[model samples]
Target: MVKNVGAVGDFDSAHETALLTATGRNQLLDAMHWIAEGRRLNGEVDGPTLLGALVAAADAGVAGAEPALRTAVRAALRSTLDTSADLVMTDGIVPPSRYEAALANVARRTASGTLVDITGSVVMAAQADDPLVIEALGLVAGLSWRDLQARAYARGTSLPGEADGSWSPSQVFAAFSVVDDVVCGRVEPQVPGAVAARPIELLLGGTASGWAAAEAMREGGVSYGTLLAQRDVGSAWSAHRNRSNNEISRLMVRRVLNALDEAGVGYWSTEGDAAVAKAVLGQRAGASGKPPGQLSIVTRAATGGPGYAVLIAIARDGGTARKTAATLLQLPKRFNVPSVLVLFGTGWADRGESDDLVRAFGGRLYTEHTLEQLAEAASTVGTS
Candidate 1:
């Protein structure tokens, strides 16, 4: 089933009154913000609407109508909110000073109410934590989830001289890198069990249809796969590989393909940032087992062949870099595949950007001097 990330239309259909009624003014407005920014509010699974429904149900006097919804609410709280303990809340307006207490109270209420007695496999409440609670508050309070991740990195940003001292360049890059991974997650569209490509997905863009690009990264990004074909073109330049092909983009893709073939990794190339975004994000997903975390490649250009490629991540999660740039040598841990090195190069047939492609993507004149080095760099760019 295709899933939509927003609930504006659903909210309108669910609530029906076009004017954004009094009782739901805050709720509707909050819901609208989420819908406008592209997040979901459905009453099913771990969605924002589940919380709204819980409050609504409680307001409506339904005692157990919240079991399924409650479980889902708790699950999201733990995963997205950053709480490590079972979630809890108090009925009244939560005071800033008593936020922790409010959570504990909610936990107590839950433990005494349905949490302690849940027997179905619908939710693993025991493993549920407080981070989940905060996320619920984030959605209800109208806070941006993206800001939450930014705040996490921001913490590391303010620590005395050691802040800049410890953060350095790569550390800072790594923190935001983490934020990049989290903020844009589930944002890119998907194509049947795989994420689809997107033109302006979050901060980075990619080629391949959002869904097609994501699905293209099978094997958890072990190979260059489709994830790197077209990502927000960080660099670009056109080349006339064959006068017959003519356009800079075609030359870029053909060159990239040739490089991948030389490295023995397969790929799914595309023309736009959407398709590339689909591929880049897909490489980090496993869909089964562990979300794919290594051997990455990200190539996205502004429409010129021989586009720019950035060494986003490398040699991570016991994997090899089938294709990716070299400067992404920012992350600490990397899993290198000497024989299965991941390589990346982007550009269109219309313009010439081979210089940027080489510099950012890494190879020849870029960062990698050997297959071993390149393999390691590309492998971890996505996961780290």
Candidate 2:
């Protein structure tokens, strides 16, 4: 059992002694907890001293301090550490190996939501060749494109280059660029366990099977749009296609949103009647009419490449096809979009009716038996 170590002395010197002494797991945890208690008592911890001690503990293979270490890291990052002085300093108190281990332990912990704001600091402070750098790259890969770009842009001021083991300004910026490329799908993750997480993967119930299917389709060169379309394409086109457009349509709408998200496509769902009235026709389709599922999306050309604007409609077999078609056709004029896609669930244009509908809507009509198929088709058409 360890006795109360008393007040930490000479911030810099005590840091090194504690680091060397806290080699065992229990000792490391105790040291970390002590630091936490110190912070509680002292109102704040000396950033360099705390980080140096924690990093040394991590280098000793002490796993128990991971959570507390992450918290300290978050607090450290949130502090107004200088991009040059505080953030990049690795000379006196922290050696390269210890710094690397400390960073690695922090990155190993998954951070989401508001805690994610610490990303920019971590990136700015990271040294090249650190394994934690790889973990940092992985974390950014899961962020939205806009967020990724913002991160890259935030590192405007460059840190001075190091002569020895630390990362230089150019090296740090280059790492950010690589991470951005990976998120954009222009470059793939080369490191193990560095896979990017799509928004759909965050779903607890549907994640496993959905991710597996998505992976299979991705390997097959299937765009998320195409995959969604194919899923909605019912095995048989008869009664399956004609099913009522109630909860199923709502469900299909959800699936479409998810598929687009998985593909990193940007979209906004709009109430069919209102969107059409405001953007297309001069008047609402009908006040009492059941609104269809409508969305405005920018579908990716290549995986993570440029996005193309498209107006999409999810219509039922009822009398909604013509109204849907009319609304869709006018969208290009209003939104200046080049493509409009209409997904139908049963009872759309019949055999004799096909020619007229085809001529009117420019043949972008696709029949879907299920919402999954519609989603696949949307992806296919959008990508194509």
Candidate 3:
């Protein structure tokens, strides 16, 4: 049963016009072929369009329409390659943002299974040997309904009729893995969720529990997961600018957690700055989550050994780092525990004209250290 692509959504004269006017003739013909498939098979899904059903069937690994879909997708890929500015918008050769949005609209109009089907063609196109196809697919990689919502939430809004789904932190991680692999030609393209496990491990430090937390964070629509791979202060702040204070703290906490994982330090108890600041500085601490400006991880020198802790302050800019240093100086008397203050940034407070900030604050600073360096640091706990 061939499914007509037009049956799934409320298409109007304008949409048809947009699809026809913005797409090249051959591309338009290829798109129409999916509709034609339904007519040829005399098997219409009754409600949705042929393309919608085809997408569903393909994702389900239904053997009937696989060959036709592959052909149609190849044509779509070629249509994407035309580089002509005159084709119909429906052909997906327009601006990358609009192209992704168009695909998202198609996804939203279909059932869950069908949505995965639609993604297959995009994945197939991405897997092609041609550079243009790869570029186009990369731009449109966030089109899955789930990714669309995540992006929308990032921009501080929800799409119409959107609902939360199961993929989280894994979705962004999955998207990252897909794009990374495709760009590097390291692995054959696969389903976003079905990619191999190594990328996640490599990105998240190979901790099973940490991966679970990341999945939950992603599922709750938090922005922390994708931020994991960002390795510098500038990059971290750029991606984190518009997030909430708690989220900002969470992000900072995750970095510390990753660092601790690398350093082989395990925490006895952990609390974000938001919670700890109130306890350390009182309720007037407000939402700033200041002083530490991140979580304080309590640790021991060894099993059943003396207690120690690490306080982290992430300085995206110098002023923040200076104030954080001032705030951290006061914590020793209040907590009365041996602790280390870790400053994360590039040149935020490396020096002040003549004096070094690390000396004044009694803290360790990091501008660049690969993951292995951190892990080595972790292995030598209490040595220095």
State which candidate, 1 or 3, has the greater TM-score: 3
Q: Which stretches of candidate 3 lie over 4 Å from their true place?
A: 1-240, 269-295, 305-307, 347-356, 360-363, 367-384
lDDT of 3 by residue, 1-384 (tens): 222223212434332332233222234344345433533322222112233333444444444444444432222212111112112223322354444443344344334522233343443333232223322333333233444455446645543332222233434344434544432335543577665333332334333232233233323433455445433322432222332334444554565667666566665434544454335432212213343433355544554443344555555555665666566656543444444444544424332410222322222223223223333433445654
Query: Over all chains combined, what TM-score does candidate 3 have?
Result: 0.30
Best by TM-score: 3
Top candidate on lDDT is: 2
Each model's total of backbone clashes: 88, 18, 19
For 117-213, candidate 1 gives per-residue lDDT tens digits of 2221211221133323333322222223344445545656431222212233433343333333333353445466855322233224345332233
lDDT: the better of candidates 1 and 3? 3
Model 1 Cα shift for residue 59 (angstroms)? 76
Question: Please, what are the lDDT tens digits per residue for candidate 2 over residues 103-199?
Answer: 4443434253121323444555544435345333433244422344354456553322322335555655654564545444454456888744433
lDDT of 2: 0.40
| Ranking of all candidate structures by their TM-score, best first | 3, 2, 1
* Candidate order by decreasing lDDT: 2, 3, 1
